[model samples]
Target: MMMKKKSKLFVNCEEAVKICDKSQYNEAGLWDKIRLKLHLILCGGCKKYSSSNSKLTSLCSKAKLNALTHQQKEAMKKVIESESAK
Candidate 1:
């Protein structure tokens, strides 16, 4: 129907954002990417948001960040607990 076709081509800002994130992770479907690109063309705010998201993703990959190890995390937790107990 008309509604279904409209929904397929257009997306709100929130849905656009979700699709943008999924696209970044290579998880978005082709239809979703098409919808997101259409929405971004029509919505400046979403376009800006998608651009920023891409930049952040690129920066994070370049940074090559790492999370604390289990031992490090346990040590930090114990320190926090001990401090709180004092």
Candidate 2:
């Protein structure tokens, strides 16, 4: 007969974050998502990161924000400088 080993129930912050990111992309397994939720319950920082990542994803999906062009960024910088001068 063969014996099987059980995986650890709790993961460290680093592993937790990796799992969180994977979960964000819908790549994490069911167990991985459960473990991440458990870690977030104990770690405030991880929870905050998870919230922020979720927000950013939501924003990106709603907006077509594919990085600003160099010219557009320069124009924005100029506008900021002019506004600060006023």
Candidate 3:
């Protein structure tokens, strides 16, 4: 027997994270918002996870306007290259 495919309208914690990243909570469509709210109500781990991700996203947005210095960029590039080589 073939398994049924689930609809995107019903999302889980990971999907909620992706949706939240793309749209504001209030602006997200009804299904997405409802799914997220339900998950948050039942799952403490997911709630904390979502909160931290939101905070991190806000921090990154603020940092982008006043970006890293050349020295910091170079350091980041070096780190990236080293990680890629490994």
Candidate 4:
């Protein structure tokens, strides 16, 4: 007798968001693909979530380039100290 493999459960939008965040859906695996398709079918919320997440990620990447480093902090501290000494 041959044993049958158990199939994975199909999840809703909220679950899909968690799965997507963990990159569990990035692979070309069968279950992951089916989860994505199911999510698209039943939930507009998940669709918006996916789009917004991508947009936020891109904005964060751009903001990172404008962030201050430790050296800049030290330079600002030195200027403040000099001014206070006067």
Residue 74 of model 4: what lDDT? 95
TM-score of 2: 0.66
Q: Per-residue lDDT of 1-86 in model 4, one digit per residue for the tens?
A: 99966446667666688766655335445676668667767788887877787787778778886767999999999999999999
- For lDDT, candidate 1 versus 3, the one ahead is 1
- Model 3 lDDT tens row, 1-86: 99989875466767867666655434677677778777787778778877887898788778886779999999999999999999
For residue 43, give model 4's deviation from the true position in Å.
1.3
Q: Backbone clashes in each candidate structure, one number apiece?
A: 0, 0, 0, 0
Compare the candidates by lDDT and give the number of the best one: 1
Q: If both were scored by TM-score, which would come out higher, candidate 2 or candidate 3? A: 2
What digit string (tens of lDDT, one per residue) describes model 1 on residues 7-37? Answer: 6577889999999999999999999999999
What Cα-based lDDT does every candidate model obtain? 0.94, 0.91, 0.76, 0.72
The candidates, ranked best first by lDDT, are 1, 2, 3, 4
Candidate 1 TM-score, C-alpha based? 0.82
Output candidate 1 Cα RMSD: 2.8
